[model samples]
Target: MAETTAETTDVASQYSAQVASDLEQNLKEQERLSAEIEALQAQLAALQHNHSVLTNIQQALGTSAAAAVSAAESVTKVPAPRKKTATKAAASRRTKSQKPATATAKRAGKKTAKASQTQSAAQSAAPKLVELVRAHLSAQSEPRSAAEIAAALEQEQPERGIKTTVVRSTLEALVAKNQAQRTKQGSSVFYTSTDTAEPAADGDQSEQPSA
Candidate 1:
């Protein structure tokens, strides 16, 4: 009977110890679960704060973009002043009204310049008759008559069609200028270069008796 009582007490103590050990293990597990839940809740709070910051940033960016667009539109949509438009119209009308006169002046100036150039070209192309007569008389070795001078001129320059009267008039002009000496022989007037004539003022011994 004593052995049976000892076995019963041993069994009861073992059961109590096992129950206390299980209770301690359960409490440790509960503490671990609570720490895990707290950690998760902290992470959620941080994520919510980050989300709020991002949302605010996004909203600010959207507002700034909208303001920029509005400013650009306002700048592009501004209307020109009425007074400036009127002034531009007046300037356009003035230019239009002056166009005809400006064109006319330009045309007149061109015509005048062309006429002056043509006159200069014509004068340059046609040498003076006095110069031709002097050249002829200077080339002669002996005295020549006006008719002979005219014939020589016609032979040299067939385009001139020079006449004896024109040659006579040019010879008279050269004699008047002391560039030639005139001699009358038997009613026929002859000319010689002044270089061969006796040096005298006006070089005129006109109408010598036939000799």
Candidate 2:
């Protein structure tokens, strides 16, 4: 019975030692697991911070891009200064082009007015010239040629510059109006007032001397 008791005590001591070793190994494993968890947490926190920074950078880039687009759109909406200057230049050129035509039209109008005035003056003087010619012819006792009538008119009125052709035309006009009579002697023509002259035959060719 004493031997059995000693064996039982030895068995109990071995079991207690085995139990202590197992407890110590379990504690070490727990410590190692806790250290691993701390490292993993630190890595996770760093990743989250990096993600936040990246997100902020992306947002800033997006805002900058939007601003750039808006600026470009605004620039496109406004017209360029050069285009305005070109439009002004074209308008100025058109004005300059029109100025010459306006000036030419004014000059043409002035010329036409001057011509009308000259024609009116000539018409007004024609009747007085005819009357002067008729009076000179009536004062003569003999028929006078156009040259003699012109010379006499110039001598009577020094201010008058009577031409032979004008005197001839006036005499012809007077003959047409039955205010004067014309005679042709060879190549010379003579004019006399109708009141003081008699009509001659068609075949008669005679020269009369001036009185």
Candidate 2 Cα misplacement greater than 4 A, ranges: 77-211
Candidate 1 lDDT over 91-188, as tens digits, reads: 66556655654565556556655765775587578877678889888888789998999899989878756767667766776888899999989868
- Give TM-scores for every candidate, taking all chains together and pairing residue i with residue i: 0.40, 0.36
**Deviation from native of the Cα of residue 25 in model 1, angstroms:** 99
The lDDT per prediction is 0.72, 0.72
> What lDDT score goes with residue 92 in model 1?
67
Residue-by-residue lDDT tens digits, candidate 2, 121-197: 86577557789999998888888998999899989876546666667767877999999998889868899997667
Residue pairs in collision within model 2 = none
lDDT of 1: 0.72
Model 1 pairs in collision: none
The 10-residue segment of model 1 with minimum total lDDT is 199-208
- Candidate 1 clash figure, as a count: 0
